[model samples]
Target: MGIHWKIKSFEALSTHELYDIMKLRSTIFVVEQNCVYLDLDGKDKVALHLYGEFEGKIVAYSRLFKPGISFENASIGRVVVDANYRERKWGHDLMREAIAGIKTHFGESKITIGAQLYLKKFYESHGFVQTSEMYLEDDIPHIEMKRESC
Candidate 1:
């Protein structure tokens, strides 16, 4: 089977959809990573949510932000693919959709992301260039990356 992609605003998300999103995020960013930080940073209300559903469950997801929210340029954050689904290369698919979503929804040419240091090469493959030195975000080593409009 193939994955289905969907993009929606916070207000447009159904309660079940929102719950699944939060569950997936917590499963990855919290339990899997062992990170202890505030997952609900109060940004969801304004950012766009992009997710990939497989077998009726969200297996991949990301959040899109317009300029001036998380960075000076449009941004993509919370990029994730379910643990069981990593082998399918859905991370790349999620990013492709995210970049397009930013351009289509925000009319922005450039995008920035605070990516985990270990995944620098993965994000670079999508044209995101490292823009900042590594820093600690949520106790994880991270660096800022930027992808300019083509």
Candidate 2:
């Protein structure tokens, strides 16, 4: 089956949708990555959520932030694709949808993200250029990247 995409603000998310989102995030960011940091950082209330569903499950997910939330420009973060679906290259699809979501929802062309160091090329393919020196977040090497409005 093909992926189904959805974008919703915090209030628009149904209880089940919210649960699945948090569960997917925890599965990847906390358990899979072995990173222990607060996932609920009080940002969701103001951010836009983008997710892709497959077979009634959330297989891809990301969050979009308006300017001044995570960066001076609009931003995309919490990018994740279900481990079961990663081999299918849904990460790229997720990003493409996320870029569009940022442009459509926020009407902002410039987007910034603090991406994991290893995935620099993945983000680069989406037009993100490294804007800051490598740094560590949650003990994971990360770099700030930016994509100007196109």
Candidate 3:
């Protein structure tokens, strides 16, 4: 079966959905990865959230920003997919929809992302190219990448 997609702003999120989103982000970014970085950086209200829910759980998610908010250009961040759903290849699907939403809602032609270094190839497949040397954010290796509007 295919995943279901939901894109909404912080205000539009139901309490339960908001909880699930935070839980998933923490589960993967904090507990799973063992990274204690601050996840809530006062940016949610300005972002458009993208989630792929399956059976009432947020299996995949990302937060998209308009230009000059998170980066000098529009960007996508906090990309995550639940461990249980990894085998289903939902990450790619989630990102494709996120990029589409960026184009549709923001009319943005270019976007930047500070992606985990290991997933560089994955993001490149979607047209994002590395634009900077690798750096550590919260002790995890990351690189800046950008994709121009297609």
Candidate 4:
């Protein structure tokens, strides 16, 4: 199966779309990860939401921020792939579009991300390089990474 991609601002999100995004986030980040951090960090109001849907259900998601929004540089956050569909590898597609969205919409090639430690190589394959030491966020180890351009 292939993913149908959508990118929109918080205000542009329909109630249903927003619900699906939140549900999926909670499912993966909260329940599955067994973490209790606040998912709504007030950044969504300023970020662009990117999600992939299959058969009317959202299975992957991420939020994109312009430079100076999430970090000193444009960033990608809240990356998640539905546990049920991980074997399908839609996470890669979600990331490829998110990177392209930054260039196409924000005219930025340099991007930053606070990625979970376990996915360091996954992010590396997409051109992100670790730039900070590992630290815990909501009890999950994470590291800062940057993609200089392209």
Candidate 5:
């Protein structure tokens, strides 16, 4: 038994599921990364949420947006894995599920992502190639990357 993957619309997530999602996100993106930025950017209302649970804990997650919501192409963002699960390839699993979800749900194959620079190769492995020069988002180096339809 590995990660139990779930993708839900904003209105479908239960209160407890939402809480766990936020807590895991803040733990990694805010506290662990030491970044002080608004976590609730108001986009979750229309985005599709993807989450993974292992041993009853939510350990991996990301959000997907339809075309014209986050970018010209359908996009994936807010990617994170529990600190404890990083060595187990769950990050890769999250992205694979997310990319497929975008295509399956949005009917789009081209996807864009604002990828942290340190993980450029990681995103590249999922077919994203850098499309913009380095820029700082929340004080962390990031680059725009896109994966075109195969």
Candidate 6:
């Protein structure tokens, strides 16, 4: 068996599931990145959570947003793969699922994201184009990217 994918809204997430999501986000976004920002931005309530689970642990995760929620276009954020799982192609898998989920749930093909500068090419491979200059967010360099439906 391989990783399992799940897409759920805030209201549909169980307490443990929510906790696991938060834990993974913090592990990467806060500790690994060493950037301190409000992780709970009060937007998770409206976004769709996409994650991959393996062996009972959340390994890869991203959040999908409908238009007008996080950005004017459909968006995917908080993309992460457990550091140990990076070699397994889970990151690509997560983004593929996220793009599909965005289309499935929002009926939109235009998607945007605030991606870490280091991962620009990774996103570009998935059809995202850099739309903004390099900028600092919580002391880490980031770039805004957009993907339009082909």
lDDT of each: 0.96, 0.95, 0.93, 0.94, 0.95, 0.94
Task: Write down the worst ten-residue block by lDDT for model 3.
Answer: 49-58
lDDT of 4 at 75: 93
Off by over 4 Å in 5: none
* Candidate 1 local distance difference test against the native: 0.96
TM-score of 3: 0.98
Query: lDDT per residue, candidate 5, 41-133, as tens digits?
Result: 999999999999999999999999999988999999999999998999999999999999998999999999999999999999999999999
Candidates' TM-scores?
0.98, 0.98, 0.98, 0.98, 0.98, 0.97
lDDT of model 5, residue 2: 87
| Tens digit per residue, CA lDDT, model 1, 1-150 | 899999999999999999999999999999999999999999999999999999999999999999999999999999999999999999999999999999999999899999999999999999999999999998999999999883
- Clash statistics: count for each candidate: 0, 0, 1, 0, 0, 0
Off by over 4 Å in 2: none
lDDT of 3 by residue, 1-150 (tens): 678999999999999999999999999999999999899999999999999988877899999999999898899999999999899989999889989999998999799999999999999999999999999999999999999974
Question: In model 6, what are the clashing residue pairs, if there are any?
Answer: none
Q: Give the per-residue lDDT digits (tens) of candidate 2, residues 35-136.
A: 999999999999999999999998899999999999999999999999999999999999999999999988999999999999999999999999999999
Q: RMSD, each candidate, Å?
A: 0.6, 0.7, 0.7, 0.8, 0.7, 0.9
Candidate 1 structure, TM-score to reference:
0.98
The digit string of per-residue lDDT tens for model 4 on 1-150 reads 588999999999999999999999999899999999899888988989999999989999999999998789999999999999999988889899999999988999999999999999999999999999999988899999999997
